[model samples]
Target: MFHIVFVEPRIPPNTGNAIRLSAATGADLHLVEPLGFSMTDAQLRRAGLDYHDLASVTVHPGLDALWQALLPARVFAFTASATTSYADIAYRRGDVLVFGPEPTGLDARVLEHPDVTDRLRIPMLPGRRSLNLANSAAIAAYEAWRQLDFAAP
Candidate 1:
């Protein structure tokens, strides 16, 4: 399974949907704080429904901690400004798909991190802003999974 890293996410419903995504895809979710809402947030739980316990979700205090834990993995930071398309990559089992906060997206510093193998983007029609956080994650996750033929028994 792939690793989904959400850095400084501010929206509860988005994170909740991501939790569901993790459970459905067998991907682990890593959240870098400081988060805008509590893990026990009702809205989040409601959005995730009964899948929270089924997903492997971990929260890290900061980016350093996240980097330390996910070292040696191919980390692909997703951003709308990137030149590379998300579908162009040959994703592996342990690859890390890193996303930024919903409001601001990934900072320039985070995007330039030495650990990031590349910055990727999902193509959209002309003049569009961006897709929702969870939607973007689902798109990337399913694309990677599809590349591997779904890898289900």
Candidate 2:
């Protein structure tokens, strides 16, 4: 029941890959406004995400729309500057795992929003750049699912 949210994602392939991850994990996928490409974009649909994977995808005009639709679920912002590692958080069902854009990352305003429960980071090599957005989201989602004992029927 976890929700994977991407804020103003800039790359189509990354988002497409995320959609596949969502479908595989049974997580709802939310995409915020100002996307770099359309859902019908050829590249996007061809990036290993099939139409079935898009079944659970939801497009929000803005963060406010997402807020309204996903209320009561705590949002955990994933940022490179965070002090707490993502694994340290006791993730729960229905929590929203929020990620940022490819190059610029999350907006400070969004990261600091009152609704965001906490900021989390993945430990990386010292002085290294951030991991690819899709990879980071997969790692976070898998860890959260792991903590849930790989929930399944």
Candidate 3:
């Protein structure tokens, strides 16, 4: 399975959608705080994610803790500034796909993190900023899953 990590997420519905994506793809979800909303917030529930859909999620206090837990795996930072396409890489099982918050994408410090294996971006129209958080994760996760031939555990 792949690992989807959201750093300092600032939206509830996006994360709720990610939870559903995680459930559907069997890819684990990891969130780094401080989140914009509580896990129990009504907005999250309103997105239609339920307890079972959240089973694959794991919340981390910070990036440091996340590195410790997910070491020995390739962590790709998704950023608009990246020169490499997300599809260029040969994804393997247990790879980690990391995304930044909504309003602003990943900061320079995060892109420079030692644990981050490389940077990637999804192609978009010229002058367009970026895709929705949940949508980006879904795109990358589906690509990786497809590369693995949609294997099941």
What is candidate 2's lDDT per residue for 27-122, written digit by digit as tens?
Answer: 888999989998887777877456454448899999889899998778899999999999899988999999999887899878988899999999
Clashing pairs in 2: none
* Model 2 segments more than 4 A misplaced: 51-55
Model 1 off-target regions past 4 Å? none
Query: RMSDs, each prediction?
Result: 1.1, 1.4, 1.2
Q: RMSD (Cα, Å) of candidate 2?
A: 1.4
How far residue 119's Cα lies from its native spot in candidate 2, in Å, is 0.3
Q: Which pairs of residues collide in candidate 1?
A: none
TM-score of each: 0.97, 0.95, 0.95
Question: By TM-score, who's the top model here?
Answer: 1
The global Cα lDDT (0 to 1) of model 1 is 0.94
Candidate 3, pairs of clashing residues: none
List per-prediction Cα lDDT, in the order shown: 0.94, 0.87, 0.90
Q: Over all chains combined, what TM-score does candidate 1 have?
A: 0.97
